[model samples]
Every structure is written in structure tokens, then in C-alpha cells.
Target: MEKIKNLQHSSILFGILFLFLFVIGSGYYLLRKNMLQNHKAQREIIVLDIQTKVESLLSALLHSYTLKKEEIQKKHKEVLSFLQKCGCDPLRLNLTPLYQKLNANYTPPRYNIYITDENLTIKNTTFKNDLGFSLRFAKATFDKHAKEHIIGVSTPLLEASTQKFFSYSDSYIPKTDKILQLSYTYEASSQRFQKIQHFLHKMGIVRATSYIILNDGFINKIDFATQTKEKLAQVIEKNQEDAKKILKTLQTKSRSIRQNKDLQTIYFVVDSPILKDAKVLYSITFDESDFYLKLATLKIVFLVITLFGVVGIIFLWYLRKKEIKLSYQEQFLRSAMHEIQTPLSVITLNHEMNTLKTGENEFTKEITNALQILELSYNELSFALLATKQEHKVEKLSLVEIVQKRVSYFKAVAKSMQKKIIVESEDPSCIMISSIELIRIIDNTLSNALKYSDPKSTIKVEIKQSNLCISNKGKKILDTKRIFERYFREDSAKGGFGLGLFIVNEIAKKYDIKIKVNSTDKKTTFCYHFKEAECI
Candidate 1:
């Protein structure tokens, strides 16, 4: 009877252990499966969202191009009709009104308008001195072919006589069939691109990003909102090769998306064949890191939760068998504190050096700037530690003076980039706040402006009666909602610790200052309100 009881107890314990293993294994498998499904769904949504945005932006661009093309075609037709009705020969017809209209209202990327006779001789032109000149090479070919067909567009090619590349769109008179060719040259260099660059920056797109409108081996026009020499060369080379492949691909495929070999980026290409025998290719690239960062954050949260769950289960199992350990947490805190102190010490040393009686030279300037950057980095880490420790101090002080001091310090850095700092204040009095806390707020805002603003653009610093504003002309701040969170950067290529704005918010809260951000495709503004405390 004793042997049988012992056997039964051992069997019961084995059964319970087996059940526990099965339950844990099943739970883990299900959780992993669900997480994978969620990841897949999120990827699909991202692709779809990006596609939609590209399509909308492309539509707007094409619509604007089409409107200009149509207007030119309409005016060309009107001129032809008027000449025919007046019975004036092409060579003899006065085109001053037409030239005036073209010059006043229409400024296409390249090539000016010209009216020629049936014999392929230029009769009149919008160009001041080109009137009465004979058509040559591509222009002559365009005239000859246009006379035969009466209505069509020319292929992209350079004109020998004029030494210019042109695209001609022609219209035929119904009964007479007299052809009128409206020539547009491909200059590629125009102020329109500069405007587009500014627009992209305002939209919060990275400055290093670029766009090109290309056909075949010939690049009609290219736009670079922000470009370094290396980046420009890379883009030119890549596009030269990619344009050929893309053109060929368009011939076979409707729409295609692919990742570059580096797998760090993605490109979406869309081709639309338009009315004038022209193909418009729209290509956009999105940084893979942006999407990956979001995924990483989610994964981190999942891992943390999993770790907690595992610890809870282990603790339940060993409650009567094991004692708790507190040394690990203490060690982590100590290590973190040590890391924080090192930077602080460097900042203090640098600050002392900067204030010393040193000569004002390039080296001194560079060192001072570096020291300021180091200080900002140190402050960010310090603030993070303080938050984790749940220690916050609030004080009241003059907000205007804080902003002014930051602007003064940042002016030197901005000047190095050939950028100017402009300040406008409604009140020149004191604000209620702690100096350190206020410095934290201003430092983050100004540092962001200096780091991201266009190299030679002006950063506007405005202080109204109750609000403090800082505006910069650069890439608009992307994901403004999460920009204040730790480890968030609009462009990963711009290396930063990403805790600046996060600390800014912490300091703002400690001082009871309300912060607001507004951005568009041309400018980004961050405003701080001090309504609670009146200006002294």
C-alpha cells in the first residue's frame, strides 16, 4: 500500500509539469503567430498609404502641366485662324500681339514659339531677333514633318542651327491644313526648380532628396531641393542608368515598385503617356528606416511585455524556493549615472575653456560650437535621467530674455552655415521661469532650427506678448505628433541622439509653459505660450 501511494504522487507531479510546459509553449506560439500577422498587415497598410500619397501628388503636378500645355495649344490655334482670316501670308503677318501674349502669360521650361511658312522658313518668332531666320535641323525636320501630317508633336531631339533641344506641338487648320508648330526647348535650368525645391522643403521632405523629369538618355529637366556633390553625382549616375531601365519597363509594365539593392530605401515609379507623344515618369523614394523605426518601437514594446510575463511566471513558480535580488537594479542605476556624469564633466570643461582669454580664430570658433553641441547632448541625457527619477522642479522667470540669449548663442552657428537669425519681440520684459529650464527649452528649439534649416536661409525668432515663436525655412518637421518623443528623428541620415525635443517638453511642463507647433511645405514654427504668467 505504501509503494502504490508513492507511485501515485510521482505520477500526479509528472502530469502537472507536462501540462504547464504545454500551456506555456502553446501560448508563446499563438502570441508569435499573432504578432507576425500584425506586422504583415502593417506593412501592407504602409505600402498602400505611400502609393496613395504618390498618386495624389503626381496628379496635382500633371494637372498643372496639362493646363499650361492646353493654354499654349489654344493660343496657337487662335493665331493660325486669325492669320488665315486676314489673308496675310505667314511671312507678312504681324505677330506682335501673339508674341506679347506669349511673353506676358506663358513661360514654359524651354524653347520659344515660332510661326513658319509652308516652305519651312521661319516667318515670325517670339524671340526678339530670331524672326525671319530659316529653320534648321530638328526645327526644319519638325516643320517638314508637321507640313505633311498637319497635326502632331515632335520627338525629343536637339536642333543643329539653333543649338537647342526642342519639343514641338503643332495644330492643323481644318480645310487649308496649314500647320502651326509651338516649339518648347529643354533648358533644364530654370527658377521653377528652385521654387519646387522650396515647396518640398516646406513639406518636411529631406533636403538631400531630389526629383528628375527624364525621357530616354536626355534629361529634360531636373530638380534638387537639397543636394551635396556626392549625392548629386550619385543621383545623376543612378538616374542615368535607372531612367533607361524605367523607360524600358514602362514599355512592358503598367506600374511597378522595387527596393534598391541596398534595401535601405524604396522607389515607386508611375508612367503616364500624355497627348503629345510624351511619357511622364513620376518616381518617389521613401526611407525604409522611417518605417522600420516604427516597427522597431512596436517590437521593443512586445519584448518588454514578454520579459515581464516570463518574470511573473518564474516568480510564481519559485515563490517558496527563491529569494529576490535587488542588486541588478542598483547596478543599472549606477552605470546610467556614470554614463551621464562623463558628458556633463566634458561640457563643464568646454564651457570653462570657451570663457577663457583665448584668441578668436577658426579653431576657437569650431571648439566653441562643438562644446555647445556637447552641452546640449549632456543636458538631454540629464533630463532623461531626471524624468526616470521622478524629480522635476518648476520656477517662474522671463521667457523673452531666455529666447534672446539662445538666439544670440545660435547666431554664431547659424552664421557659419551662412544663415541669419532674425528676432522680433512684442515685450522686452521678464518672464517667470527657472533659467536652466528655460535654457533647455530654447536650446532644443534653436538647435533643431540650426541643424535642419536651409544652409543659407533665415531663422525667424518672434516673441509676441504671450507667445514665443521660432520659425525656420527647411524640411518641414515630419511626424510632429511624435517628434517630442525620445529617439525620434525626421531623417535618420541626420545623426542625432533624438532626445532634444523630448527634454524640451519636460522642461516646458516643469515651467508651466504651453508649447505648440505648426508646419507647412515652406516653413515650420514652434510656439511657446506664457499666458499664465504676465510679462513683467
Candidate 2:
């Protein structure tokens, strides 16, 4: 029996698809995790870079301020020394005319200089208005600190928006009982830094790009809103919260990823190491959507490539499995076909020898039975070898004769089983069919009759009206409709390939013979009805 449990193509397809999806899904999940981790690393790099920028900006601003203070001190010393050498007292001399002399004294036409008495009273002025800022801040700062440095003041108050940072350094003159003040503003550098809008666009800096640099003790400074590489600046008011928070909480630099669930945002706060000798917090807030957008295209391409490659690999593997399975089945069938030949030849030769010597005895019948069974096995092997591509050779033959030959062929089998075939044929029952095909039909019908019939029962084989009918008194076919289908068997215990009946039907159809089946509780009959037949 050919127990070919062949895997169906559809089943292979479904399995491959399932495997493909599982593999791709797992791969996709891993890739996404990797991409997310890489994104975090990239964000850290950007944060560190921004922090470095802020630190450098701070250093440059401190240096610029220190330079401005030193320049003011240098200029003030020069003016005061010249005034003392000329026997000039800034308070006693009509110093209002000294403004032009002072202007001419400096090559770059120095900052507005003024002389004021130590009692915080303005005595001389660059412009009479002087905004009173120079006197107020200079005196308040001078009296407040035991140690004196540049009185860097914005105005009478920190928010006083002259948009200028004033650096005031005063020199006391013993001959004058007055102090000379030199002041300058960073308005030029601030304006130039604010013009970095184009450069900011190039760097992909968005509205969220903001930072604060604390000046430690000073309330007046420039903000990054007008920041440049030349100067790091920040407004005191803008930094008040962070500055106060740091002073109160002293939060350290954090490297962990922080998330805001409500806002669906992530960020990092880098506390730069006391930049320019001042503690500062430089945090960069980024909307996650931008980074997602950046990864979206890459992710799409990756998925497409991965899916395509995975499907290709799975399909190839499926094909390989199918090919290997078929290869093994074919190899086994060939090996079986080859392996059975020696026994088959021995049985056939023994049957022939025994038939010649004993002339129709029971032992000779048994040998013939073995030979007949061997013949069927050989034919089945041939059929498997052919894979159903047998050469056709049509001939005119008497239908009754072919039926007799097949009945005689199965006679040993029938006798061993204690069953008999009763043949009734009319004269000249000739048909045009491949002789091999006709033998196949007759042998299959007779074999089924002997296999399924009750022992000692009669099988009636009749060829009348150019039609053959084989009827057996045996177990009735439960499903006559499917009895002739390949691999279908009414009784699996009666071992055969189950190919016989199906071959009968197919050959009958090919030769334009109509086949039918009729089954009852008592009898089952298979008919091969010839059409368009001619007989003499």
C-alpha cells in the first residue's frame, strides 16, 4: 500500500507565512529597541554639545566683562593722572568744557566719563541726565561691598531696559575730592549676537532652544536671546527661577532619561561644572515628535527591507523542504521497487515450474497466487515509477476474452479465499481500447470483488450488450460515490494501494467507457459500460 502522506502545498504556504511573520515581528521588535537606544544616545550627545556651547559662551562673556573692566580702570587712571599733573581740580575747575578735552584725550572717543563727589552727589556729567544711574548704582554698590571691583550695573534697577550693561570703575583724586567714573555697554556685541537667527536656522535650533547662564552674584547680564560665541549672556529675570531653585535645592547634573507623561516629552538637564567660576544649569527641552520624524523614514525603509528579505528566505526554505520531502519519497519508492524484484522473480519462476509439474493442484495454485500478488506489486511499482504517464496503445480485442483472462488471472486468489467468479458473456463482444488499459480495468474489478466478497460467495462477471458488470456478494460500499477515488478504501484492513478502482475509472473515461456503481446491503456491483462499440 502506498501510504504517501504528502504535505499539501497550501499547508506549506500557510506554515511559511506564519514563520515569516513571527521572524519578521521578532526582528522588527529588536530593531526598534536598538533604534530607540541609539536615539537616546544621540540625544545625550546633543545635550552634551549644547552644554559645552553654554560653557564656552559663559567663558567668553566673563572674559569680555573682565576686559571691559580693565580697560575702564586703565582709562580712568590715565585721565586722573593727567588731571593731577595739570594742576586741575575736577570740582573746582569748570569741568563742563573738559568733556571735549576728555573726548579728545582717548583715541576711540572713550565712554561717557563723569566726576561725582563721594557723598553720592553728581558734580560733573557727560550728559546732564546721565540717567542718575551712574551715581545711584556706583554709590550703592561701593558702600555695600568692603572689597571694590567693577560696578557692573544695568540701571537704577535690574529690569531698567536701557538695553545696556554699564561697567563703572571710579578713581579717587586727592587734589579734587571727587571720583571719575568710566562706563561702557555691551550693546554692540549684544546686537551682533542677536543677528544669529540665520545661523540658528542652519543649526536646526527651534523655539525650544533656550538656556540660562548664571553670573553667580550679578543681577545684570546678557541673555542667550542675544547670545554669540564671542559672549555668553543671560537675563537675570529669565534665570531667577532656576537660580533660586539651584540655590535652594542644589540639584546635581542628571544623566538619566526623564519623561513627562502628561506632555509626552523627554529631556535632560546638564548642570555644567561651575562655568567661568559660576554654577549654572543648562537644560535642553526637545519635543519627541521631531526625533520621531527623523527616525520615521529610516524605520520605514528598514521594515520594508527586512520583510522582503524574510519572506524571500522563508519562501526559499519552504521550497527546499518540499523538494527534500519529495526527493526522499521518490528515493524510497525507487528503492522499494528495486528491492522487491528478487522475491517477485523467484515467486514467478516457482509458480511457472510448479504449474508445469503439478498441473492445477492446490500447492501450484498457492504458488500462482503468490505470483499473481507479485505481479500486482510489480505493476503498482511500475505505476509509481510512471507517476501515471503510461504510453497508450489502442487495439481491437474481444471484451469477453479480456474479462475471462482477468477472471482466470485472479482465480488463484479467489480459490484461496473460497470465492468463485461466474462469467456470462455474449458472442463477438469486441471493444477498441488499449489492451493494457482494458487489463487494468478487468483486473481492478476482479481484485476488488475477491478482496471484498464474503468467503465462499460467488462473484458474477457478465459481458452482455458490450458492457461488463462485476457483482460481488459482500460488504456493501458505504460511499459508492467516492469508492473509485484514489487512496479511498471501504475496508482499510484489506490492504491495497486503493489505486485500482481509481485507475479503472480514469482509464474507462479516457476510452469513452461509462462506469457506474450500485451497492446494497447484500451486493455491490461495478459496471464498465462501453459506448459506440462495434462487433461482428
Candidate 3:
């Protein structure tokens, strides 16, 4: 009977083990399949989103350019009307008054305005010396197309004679159908397209290409890529064949001539055909890296989800066994806390005893200062724990007074470090803020200023209406953009958890205050602009 019982027990254990292995294998297979499906779906969505965003961006740009062209045309018509009143004599037209009026009325700066005859000969121009010259040579290509079109603008081009870059062109058609071209030139290295380019760059496009097609089969290409002009030209030429293929595919898919294409080079081609009798195609191309970046981002999300699922299973198993280990964890935490407290208490007591015995000796004072710094650090840690673990109360108090008090508290430390704290104020009134938060923000700033300031130098504090500005002479920040980020520190030698500015930023944001920093090689200033509250 005993032998029979042992055999049954062994058979039961083997069956349970086999069931576990089978379940695990099945779960792994299902998880892998689900992950692959999710990744594919995510990639498709990303590609579609990128396509939509690029289309929208191109539409906006084209619309803006079109509007600008319209405005320029309207102004040109006004100028032509004024010229007609002056009797069609180019030399006697006297465009000075009209030029002044346009300069005052125009939204953007104007470069020059020119009037041309039926033969496209320059009759009169805003630039006096260029009058009666053949502008046809310089603007002939663009003028030939502009004569038929009512309104159009040219892309950025470098003028050979002046060696300057021009960004705009506007044409007017009078009753006689003569054309007048108004041009605008901007500084080459200015921030003209910075915002637009930055937006595109953030979307992960390495380059952008735009084409303005005239009714006469003339194309004006605008390359916004960082690549050199020659390299970009080569790239465009190489991709033209691909563009034609894509155009065919788009026409087939949408059943419309105006459609976009997705190519193998991760580039998107969008074509917009004007509805007018003289149809022109506006084509734009954008890099496809954004689509892939979004896919990679989704993949990372899937990985995180998989990790969490695994952790959840392990966590559940741990919880099931937690009751058995509860006493052990509690004993360990108790012992750890005791061990830490014992050494801290010993250090505190020893410092106190030394200070009392020596009464004002350098060694005693130094030890006392060190102990105070340690105690302050422990207080900060305790405050952080309390803040995170429990609800905090918001109490309205004067920000200026709280700052003063925090500065007073740090006076001794500043003195020990041989640094002076100076406060300058343009406002004597109080500003409302949370007392604890105000103290934390100002304390951190003051501490950092004192720590980094030259040994004998003074840290200046200025208070204007709704603004608190602090300045200190220290090493310039390497990356000023990331100064308020968590765990960001300029100097490795500076002893800090690097949480001070980040905490200050959080508190400032909570209070709806604005913080700005201005730094140079000589000095750095941190300014906090507080929101104005009702006077008490």
C-alpha cells in the first residue's frame, strides 16, 4: 500500500510540472505574436500621421506665400494706378511719394520696385541708376512667366551684381498687361525661416524641398535642407525619376492629379495643381525619418509594456509570498534605521561637546559648521519625504519677507565661506506666495550663489515689482537651455544633489511665476517674475 501511494504522488508532481511548462510556452508564443502585430499597426499609424502632418505644413506654407503674393500684387496695382496719373512718362513718374506711402503701409520691408515696358524693358525703377537698363537680363526668366500670371513670388536667390539674397517677388498686371515687379531682400544669416525650420527639424526631417511651378513649365526650386546647394541639386536630380514614378502612383491611388506619393527613400512627395486655366503644380518633398522615429518610439512603448507585464507577474507572485517574508523586511528596515541614526547621533553629540568645550576656537567652529550643514541636509531630506508622502498645506505669505528670512538663515554659512550677500530692491511692497515654497526657492538660489561665487565676492539680490533677480560671479553654464533640468550641474566639484533648481522651477511653475536666466562670461543672473496679486 505504501509503494502504491508513493507512485501516485510522483505521477501527480510530474503532471503539475508539465502543465506549468506548457502554459509558459503558450503565453510566450502569444505575447510574441501580439507584440509583432502591435508594432506593425503602430508603424502604419505613424506613417499616416507623418503624411498628414507634412501635407498640412505644406498647405499652410503655400497659403501664406500665396497671401503674400496677393498683397504684393495689390500694392503693385496701386503703384501702377499712381504711375498712370503721372502720365505714363517713366522719368516724370516721380515714384518717391508712392514709395514712401508703400514703405509705411507694407507689413514687411521692401527692397525695390520697378516698372517695365511691353517689351519687358526697364522703364523706371526705385533704384534710380538702374532706370532705362535691361532688367530683362536679370529677371527675364521669372518675368516671362510673370507676364501671363497675375500674381506670383520667387524663392530666395542670390543676385550676382549685389551678391545679396532676395526672398520675395510680386508682379502687377495693368490694363495694358504691362508687368511691374517689386522685390524684397533680407539678410542671409537672419532668423527669417528659423521658426519654420525648427518646427520641421523637431519633426525629424533632415531636409525639405519645395518647388514652385509656373504655367509655362518653368520651375523654381526652394531647398531648405542643411546640405550644400550643389549636393541638394544633385539629390533632387537623382530623385526626379522617383518623383515621376510616385506622381503616377498618386494619380492612380487618389484618382486625382493632385495627390502625394511615399517613396522607398523615406521621402514624401506632395503635388498641388492650381485650378486656374493656367494650371501650375506646386510640389513639396519631406524626409520620412519622422515616420520611422515615431515607429521606434512606439516600439519602445511596446517594450516598456512588455517589461511591465513581466514585472506585474513577478510582483503578483511576490505578493503571494509576501506574508512569509513580512517579518524579515520589517526587522531589516528597523535595523537599518537604527544603524544610520546611531552614527548621526554620535556625530551630533560629539560636535556639540567640542563646541561647548572649546568655546570659540577655529577647530570647534569648523566642526560646528560642518555639523550644521549635515543637519540642514538631513532636514531637506526629511522635508522631501514628508512632501512626497503626504498632502501639503498652501499658506499665503509675503515672498519678499520669506526670501529675506532664508537669506538670514544662510548668513552664517556665507560668512564662513567669506562670501557676502547683498539685497537691492526697487519695490517695498509685499508679494503673495506660499511661505514654505518661497523659502525653498530662494534658499536654493542663495545657497548655489554663495557656493559658486568668488571667495571674497558678493552675491547681489535685486527685487523689482513682481520680480526677484539674483546674480553671482561664477563659471558660465555650459548648456544654459538645460540648467533647470533635474540632476543638472555645471561643475563636478560643486557638491549638490542637483535637485535645487529643478525644485525651484517646479515651485515657480505651480505659483504661475516666470523664471529666466541671463548669463555671460563675467556674471550670471537668475530672475524670477512673480505673478502680481491683490494688495493686502
RMSD list, candidates in order: 33.0, 11.9, 28.5
- Candidate 1 least-lDDT 10 residues: 1-10
Better by lDDT, candidate 3 or 1: 3
TM-scores for every candidate against the unseen true structure: 0.36, 0.45, 0.37
Off by more than 4 A, model 3: 1-346, 349-358, 383-386
Relative to the true structure, how large is the alpha-carbon lDDT of every model? 0.59, 0.62, 0.60
* Tens-digit lDDT string for candidate 3 (83-201): 66766665446677777877885555455777777666767778766667665554565555565765556644534455344544546444653557776554432243444456545
- Model 1's C-alpha root-mean-square deviation from the true structure amounts to 33.0
Residue-level lDDT of model 1, residues 1-536, one tens digit each, is: 11121223334444565566566567656766786688557545654554444344334445544545655556567667676787766655666766666556446534356666655556666665666665544455445655685445543344444434455676544454244667655444123334454544453333222123444333443223343457544643464335556657667665555554322223334443332333445443333445556656766765666666566556555642221222233334446657767776776676567758664678777767776676676665666656656544555666667778888888877777788999998756556665766777788888888788887899898987768889998887778889987567778887776778888887777667788899888999999886446543
Residue 486, candidate 3: C-alpha displacement in angstroms: 1.9
Best by lDDT: 2
The stretch of ten residues in a row with the least summed lDDT in candidate 2 is: 151-160
Off by over 4 Å in 1: 1-358, 388-393, 429-431, 509-512
**Steric clash pairs (candidate 2):** 222-233, 222-234, 223-233, 223-234
**Best candidate, TM-score:** 2
